[model samples]
Target: MCSVTLRPALPADLDALSALEQRCFDSDRLSRRSFKKWIKRQHDGLIVAETPERELAGYALVLLQPGTRLARLYSIAVDPSRRGQKLGEQLMDAAEDYAHEERRLYLRLEVRKDNAGAIALYEKRGYRLFGLTPDYYEDHEDALRYQKRLHYQPADAARLHLPWVQQSTPFTCGPACLLMALAALKKQTPNTTEELLLWREATTIFMTAGHGGCHPMGLAIAAKQRGLSAAVWSNQKGALFVDSVRDPDKKAVICALHEHFVKTCRQESIAVHYQDFTATDLDRAISNGKIVLVLISTWRLDGRKAPHWVAISGSDEECFYIHDPDPGEDQAPLDCQHVPITREKFEQMRKYGQAKLRTAVVLGA
Candidate 1:
């Protein structure tokens, strides 16, 4: 039997890693540039199994979500000659341990649907299939999504298992979150058409640059119109996001929309609280069977300073589980669902822009 040592990949391992990628995969191979980049990234983990002879046996790459308790097994490959020595399994163990050490709650990956050996290995490692993506590979092969729970909570029964819904467009995160919340509460299914309609109804018509994003007041009104009771909690009593817009005409339009939404909220008799919704408030609302759609700054999640919307699915003692609508191309939908963020981090992320605007829409039966 051959022995191999597993350790973090260093800059010197770049050539070996690139060569291993070429040997292990005929298509969709990682480039030398990608290997160099991943090796240098502070947040991601790249583990390599080295033989006693100093040759590479296998490698695994795990991508970490900065603000959430999620890690992804982006890639793993065992040298063709070393396949029988269980290097693949050893690398899997190392990847999972690294993620667990980082306090990640879940580790997810996508495998080519036809790769029975890889599927068997993942299943043997306790990764359960969660979804499928058609034509996910360069050769037009479908992919099967799998996720493993690194940390299990006995109190999972106390949390709401809200349905997951990905935003069809970048600006429709607010509507997508509302769609998920409404689906979980009303047992109604969500579709792209309704998502667009909700966006049309709730959009502010102009944001920092592109098309407008949904407003808390507008989302509350949309919820009420959809037969759900709604209330909004916002630190700003007047217009939101107005301070972020430098253009006079854009700011005027935002102010006008805010005024209109406020008027509609009053006419519709929706509860509007001019205050911040604390973590305690979120706990209380979830306990009372209400769904929350919160506006957060995307800086922590993706290093992009933009406002994003997410649904509060559930919570534990230390973390709030979120259903993020925008799961970027590299992430699976399961990676975005029920993503756990610590209360302290949630507080930092819940506000957006220089004004530190905080807003949440609470929905109920």
Candidate 2:
């Protein structure tokens, strides 16, 4: 057995890294250009294991997703001669450590489905299977997706375990959240068609771009239509999102939709409060067996200054658990499920736009 040292891959090691990639993989090998690019990239980590003789023994590459707390183990390879010495495990450990140091909450990877040895190694290292993709490789092999949570918390049995439903489109986050809440309360399964229908029923008709987002009042009305008792809490009394719209025609349409939603809430006898839904209110609602959907700005979560919606699944003294509807492309669905946000941060995230509007809808049986 030979001793090996793990260190960051340097430009000098690019040829060795490229050769190691070729020796390790038959079909999906990283090109020399790719190796050079990653070696110089600041946001990614490329680590190499070298012997005292300056020979490369193994290497691992981890890619970080900006605007998300996720890092991916994009590639790892160990020289065939060094197999029995547990270099693979060492590389895995290094990948995880790098991700944790970068403040990533989870690390994910994809391995070939037929790779029994690799799968066993990952499972032994606490990576759980989350999903699968067909034809994920150049050779037409299926891929097994796995993820490991870097930080773990004890499960709160009292917390509402609401079902998670990802938004189908960019603008349907509110409706996706509403569907999750409805699913939890009614024990019904939600689908994309129903998600779009809810979006159609709740959308405010115009926004900063593309399709409009759902309003709190509109979401409350949609919830009521689904046979749930709904109540809305908002800090603003004036029409929502009107100030954000520049075009007079779009503003008029938004105002009209807001008025209609308000009228529908009154006609359906749903409660509407012109006030902020505090953290105390959130915990109280969950304590009494109700589902709450709150509006939040995405700037804190994804570096995007856009209004988004998420469902409050549970609460603790220190944090509020949320199910974000849009997990983005680089994130696994599990990453967005029951995400814990601290009380102080939650306060900052719950407001949106220049008006700093805060809105929430509480749904009950």
Candidate 3:
């Protein structure tokens, strides 16, 4: 565990990252031109390890594969002189952070068969070797295709004190949408020390799964109610054209509601970003510490329900805060005048959206 700051790599960092790449790998050193291209791509993410002195120690690059539900770790390299200090792990952690931020389900990378050290490091971190590519590397060497799945448990996530989410709403939306709306509310008013903590915790949890959405809107609304300014970002679903009408106009209504909220924010002069329904967009927002709310919805109950919505209100060592909404009446009420709901059944409504839509919202500063 080296005390290193894992941050986005810029063009100014090319010389350093390139140097580390040359020293760490034999056949695939990225050229300056390649690095430039990498920096320009929106879906490509690069993070670098830096010492307190601002010296580069390692670097990792990941690219999102649209609709594949996975991210590819194009490269990761640490200075040979600084090996064994968990620099690689740190780099990998940064990569995981990037993946999680973008709502990627897994990270896939190819490693040379001869690089036992690399394989060991990856395996130690729970990466699974799923396939082998013959002659994948230079000199006709074999490459091991590895992937790591990222998961988060609610119990392990951060805790949020949004009592309003548990309150009941007369609105026709399902409980899930209600919870999501509430979660979004608290995320907005993350000014109080407690609210900020809850916000951070909530965002961190969503990052683990690489998601973002309207939960951010709710957070922003909550913040606005409290006189705070915030913005959120979530990723777009690749090629999955979403028509709110086909789904009983639920999505359309939500978007319309979101637009109305945005208009309100504009009147109040608050910042917001609804990152094009793609996880990559959401990842960028969360990595920047912006409150990103992600909703995960499934069609198991048949797509007759509103998508589940949860606020990534706060984050911690092992988990993030998931402030579910409350559509039921008579829930845990709080002193926050900004939030409109109670806290009791907030968690219950989160299940309604579980059927069709997963949304992400990022609140800006």
Candidate 4:
């Protein structure tokens, strides 16, 4: 409420920071060791808010993500006495300023899904909820991931021409991605009903209890059936998602589906490249006026085991642009659908399953 000074957190404030964190958070509170480590790191440092009496009122921890131009608000807390005085907002502003100075393009954070007050505060400060992580906290509560773009500039890459974005259903990512590729290559747009129909055509027949997602081979088969040239690039030769299911019947069904997809692809003489494809491959294909649908685990986005399918729309030396169908609720259109991430980050996100399989489907007219 009064004049509070904001400055870089120092090593001497470790114990005080920990004490304040405990008062501010009931769970997931930072430890004294963490405070000490954060205070010393240049890329991952903490900023503190001091009251008029020179006491620690609040602090914000900002961590620069490795191999990506992003900074994360790892944690933030305020003294109980400093509630309702907008100390959290001031701390966030300071954190964003620091991240921008670090040359970061985006600032993101995860808040408890039920924390409406904090969510409101973050939304008011221009942070948009991009995705949700199921059972992210120690208490098994979900976390809402939010992002704020620090700078907006037209990309330097010659972006690939891609079509409309739509995440038709929960299990339709693979189909949705493939549809975009087909539409872009065919110079046609598929409606929502047709998108869901493609999902039914390409679904794996079994999932981790809920509706199943589309398999890369099934997607290739669907593309071929639609009169498009297609090929599968993946390391998985058999039974994908079998180990992910515990029920014997579901596991059996998954194996059967995997075998069936393989049989169909082989019978149709579909080109199956059994190796990992790099960003170079993607760029070459797109530059040659082809479309590709790639598999990516959504670990970097929301810390969940979401095996997703996204179209490789365009690429430059720095980043890969994707046409994502399911960008989730509460996110801006640009943040949700059209995403630009570094090639290194895309490589990290493209692998799924226990063996971390790399997979994609290259499509052409």
Q: Report the CA-based lDDT of candidate 4 relative to the real structure.
A: 0.79
Model 3 TM-score relative to the real fold: 0.42
lDDT by residue (60-137, candidate 2, tens digit) is 889776544567898899999899888899989889999999887668888999999999999998888866768889
- Candidate with more favorable, higher TM-score: 1 or 3: 1
Which number leads on TM-score? 1
- Between candidates 2 and 3, the TM-score winner: 2
**lDDT values, one for every candidate:** 0.88, 0.85, 0.52, 0.79
State the TM-score for model 4: 0.61
Best by lDDT: 1
lDDT of 3: 0.52
Weakest ten-residue segment in model 1 by summed lDDT: 152-161
Q: Write the per-residue lDDT of candidate 4 for residues 74-150, one digit (tens) a residue.
A: 88888888789888889888999999998777788889999999999999988877667688889999989888777
RMSD, one per candidate, in order:
3.6, 4.1, 19.7, 9.9
Error of 4 at 326 (Å): 1.0
TM-scores vs. true structure, each candidate = 0.81, 0.77, 0.42, 0.61
lDDT of 4 at 309: 86
lDDT of 3 by residue, 1-365 (tens): 67788888776787887677788777767887777777666334788888998999888888764322346788887888878798888788878988888876567788889989889888998887755668775688898877776654224232333323432332212233333333454443212344343343222122111222224455555555554455544333221113323443544544555556556667766565434344344334445555544544423212334344444554433323344443222222211111211122222222322123334445444
For model 2, what is the error of residue 125's alpha carbon versus the real structure, in angstroms, after optimal superposition? 5.5
lDDT of 1 by residue, 1-365 (tens): 44898888888898888888989999999899888877777434788899989999898999888788778898999999998878888888899999999998778899999999999999998888866878889999999988887877435422646888999998999999999988887988999999999999999999988889999999999999999999999999878888878999998989999999999999999999999899999999999989999999999998899999999988878789898999887666757877878788999999898889999999998
